[model samples]
Target: MDFLERIKARKSCLKACETTVTTVSGHSYMEKILADGTSVISWPQASTSPGYVIDTKPDLQVAHVLPGLCMGSQDVAHDFGLLKNHSVTHILSLGVKPVTLDQMLNYTYVQLLDLPETNLISSLDQCFIFIDNARQSGGCVFVHCNAGISRSASVVIAYLMRKESMNYQQALMHLKNIRPVIKPNPGFVQQLKDYEKMIFTLDGK
Candidate 1:
């Protein structure tokens, strides 16, 4: 099926979310994060197609990590229309295989052979460089893997750690606060822990 058709079908089958997504003609909702670090979603009286969800149980889509960075599943990576709408300028793939989507024609693409059990510590620097360069250039980047949970999340966390000088726990908490579905594998988790020590020592932090 075409991308638009797939989106329509998915919307038709939408279920209840914590914010209670509705499709009533003219019904509206907005999501906001409060100053107390809590999020609340409320729907008012307005009308349009149901809003897109960043993360849904059993269903997957891209999630914004920062203003110029995002993480998502391979499905989101393939949806060229979505990427175009978001003005994504770069696509970083953490899967073993390269991205072969026709929709990626206009985007700079990078594929890294990052498996769940692979040694991510060695590759973290290269991944960070790619994402950092895009952000510095005022371009947006979307990183993805097969499931958008492990490999991609690891790369994002590593980037945050390097750029923000955050420890692993702090970075993980910040990511979960927004995406809420990132869970790196045990092996990756260990690597991230070791990485924290390595980077800290190098910088004398």
Candidate 2:
């Protein structure tokens, strides 16, 4: 199916979204502003796990895309305490900015110059290596761009496709299932489909 068709089919999966944050008390918390301009807070984490699942509207600041993985904006990248709280062992910067938190702690840092219009297939292999290494070490990797919707999300969806043996549709569906607001650009979406075809051809599928 084409990108637009896929989007139309999956639109219903995204609704009633909010930004999720975990409190020091080990509860999932989110603050929302209603249409009437009233602030409402909710704590839904009656339990916790090694990796907390965040289900809410896509906030560029941070969204837990999957277990052992997250995608966020540059604001999240600069927040040392947030990274530490989430036990993020690696940071993948998918923008031109030099990662400032790399030397602040012992975290592994990988930077790639990926623009919204840039084709990402060439960098997938290298990026995959860093992400895989972090996961194997029982650590999580946070991928981010200026905005989490396009560049960073594209890199992450590519990783899931290549590493997890999922096709573009499946990987994207899974991503949106977790983080509802991810919408990669059309060019990136096409590149992912191309990458999917390449993987299938290599596997003789």
In order, how many clashes per candidate? 2, 2
lDDT of each: 0.75, 0.73
Candidate 2: RMSD to truth:
16.6
| TM-score quality measure for candidate 1 | 0.64
lDDT of 2 by residue, 57-81 (tens): 4343567766778877767777878
Please give each candidate's TM-score: 0.64, 0.64
**Per-residue lDDT of model 1, residues 1-205, tens digit only:** 9999897776666543444455545466776655443568886777655455445454346688888898877777767778778778888777545455664333444454445577887777777778878888888988887787788888899888888899999989988887787889888998899888987999998
Question: Where does the lowest 10-residue lDDT sum fall in candidate 2?
Answer: 104-113
Q: Which stretches of candidate 1 lie over 4 Å from their true place?
A: 1-60, 96-116
Worst 10-residue stretch by lDDT in candidate 1? 103-112
